[model samples]
Target: MRRDSVLQIQHSFTGPDQGTKGTLYLVPTPIGNLEDMTFRAVNTLKTVDVILAEDTRNTQKLLNHFDITTGQMSYHQHNSQSRIPQIIEMLEAGQNIAQVSDAGMPAISDPGFELVQAAIAANLTVVPLPGANAALTGLIASGLSTDQFAFIGFLPRKKSEKKAFLDNLVNFPYTMMFYESPFRLGQTLEDCQSAFGPDRQVVVVRELTKKFEEITRGSLADLVAHFDENKTIKGEICFYIAGNDDPSTDESLLQAALDDMPIKEQVQWWETHESMSTKDAIKQVAKQTGINKREVYAKYHEI
Candidate 1:
């Protein structure tokens, strides 16, 4: 059954022709500075039969600046369900459409995802044209580790819900980026301090590629204090927080160990010396000695 299922699988190629189906171009608009708009994005927008915009008025300003004369249709969170079927129909009718958000990439925090999913399900050619993105722009300049990162766009509005959400990522080992409003910056900083601790490094990037762009870096506590004192922070923001570098480190688990101790002996030593339970000793020994917990458990059990 597995072999038969694998044999029946089909692959969709991005560049290949899909008969009469029209292409859905995921065009990215500049987050801030108009100069950051890519040439390809402009050309695609200009040539497409129609443009699906998050806000036609906001996107109009961008279109006007680029002298793009393409017509726009509103596709936002509220109307996405009603609009997706129509969009898929247009694509099926071979009318090339371009989707754009107010800023940055469409679908990053927007309802453009539904339309994209509809297009793909209809076997339409979906092409993405990269341009300015606030998260990546701020991340590169954030002074945080870029090797591995997660884009956690906007937390829940409710304080309790937001705190619980952040609590889950306390030991997350990748740099995290978040989009935030200037109004909530202070409160959010306070929350970060509580979840990740006061000493966790954070960078607050405001108004990227704009005339009044600002990048502030400090510990979560310092940022909380700074925002409290300043009382006014304007423009769009990208919040970058450093992840737990040594997530395994626990002060209570620290103890002297014999250099040549076996994995099982190490677990036993932690149990005897630190007065920990069998389960806890295995966990602590795994952390202290950089061994996998399951491997330590198996060794200790003589499995």
Candidate 2:
């Protein structure tokens, strides 16, 4: 075992350590439990020349817990933009740096994007180390369709803007995700219900990975009622809403065909002119003329 390990090390170190001229490593930290920290992540954090953290105090606790003595400086939403040039300078000087968020991935609905943008434009190599993400954890448990989904990050805080945001989703057919604070969860649900209708399905994930982790499943109305009785809610909230079920299609040519024709002739014309499936043409005809689709198909002898 010793000889083999030595051989492996010799092979790896055969050439000069052309250590990255200045690599920006985006490192993901555990959202809740510390045990979720990967071996590589801990090692990288310890060995990196510098670690840019969203919160120095919060990251200090994590570093102390793991016996990692590397230096950490506050680099968050408020200061990331201003700090970008300085960080890029350090990378240009051949220093290896790692960036971490308070929880989960950095530059993901969080600070660190500007620094990344600066690093890229400066031609510095950027490395990504993936780990925990709250959105995915909640999404999988939401019981909503996962084939197609959109992550809208945090919702607008202003009531009017937030309402407009939800209202726009009424016609969207893919599952949607959003992050919300516990205090705003109920209000967000209410807005969603108002826009998407009370019957639309929604799932709420709260305090994921923590002791109070909870996943509530129900329609918009049901969820609103559930939270109303609970009074106080806590922890981060990840919300998922099922997509719109109904869609409206164009009817221009069909409207023209129906203009001067009798119901029977209109239905027949639509079947031929619209070139739609016979079943679909009958349904459209029934909706437009207040006639039963089956009766229309029967009368047209097209059933």
Candidate 3:
């Protein structure tokens, strides 16, 4: 057994030898605007021996734009399984590599996590350079509280899983950020309204730093209405929903909790406490929670 492996080498955190191995520099590229690329980033990309890009074609365009000719090797979800070991081997031989996503920071909702993990496990040097980030970009312009926030990169695709995911954050007290597709914007806004309530303040930023850059801030209800009416939205998206600490947010949660109550309990409370007629109680709940009056009545009658 050749157990004298390179993985056994202790990481030298203090010196010139720290990153001498096959170093993986996590380089951040421009999300939308080309000017966002930093001078250091440009130089690094030019100097690196190889670039592991999420999309070689897109990276090639960027390279062509800046005239940086470092070779690009496709390293995306489908190709990672085969490419990782090859990249790792190259790194082990002291080849400096840079990993980049199509835009923004790699691995934050993009590819590169697996490569980073493998490099770390093998005791290789992994360096990250900060540049454009959609979440932080959206947050700064969101006019929302930036003091405390959570980055919920992307939500689950499945309905049940997505609902459970949003439900889990129903009471989060910090500003919450998310990356979602323009295609699902309407449905996502509706789901968020269902989970966080109509009154919760939310900011939806799309096509960030690009020509169609849009930043709309309002209650979840209003945004839903806007999207439903327009039926047209495009480009990258970063959604910011206000935390549970806000008074309005708290009220929305309380209303949502009441909506979650058993129909029988709700009917009894409305009928007995407020002396409201059955139809009136159903109408009130439907009005307050935005559920269909017929659905509320059916559920109430069933109970």
Alpha-carbon local distance difference test for all models: 0.88, 0.84, 0.87
- Point to the candidate with the largest TM-score: 1
lDDT by residue for model 2 (199-262), tens: 9999999888898999999999999999999959988889899987673334643465576776
Runs in model 1 with CA error above 4 Å?
1-19, 249-303
Ranking by TM-score: 1, 2, 3
lDDT of 1 at 77: 97
Best by lDDT: 1
Candidate 3: regions farther than 4 A off: 1-20, 246-303
lDDT of 1 by residue, 203-288 (tens): 99999999999999999989999899998889999999998887844453244334367888888877888799999988987887
TM-score of each: 0.79, 0.78, 0.78
C-alpha lDDT of candidate 2 relative to the true structure: 0.84
What stretches of model 2 exceed 4 Å from their correct place? 1-20, 249-303
In TM-score terms, candidate 1 sits at 0.79
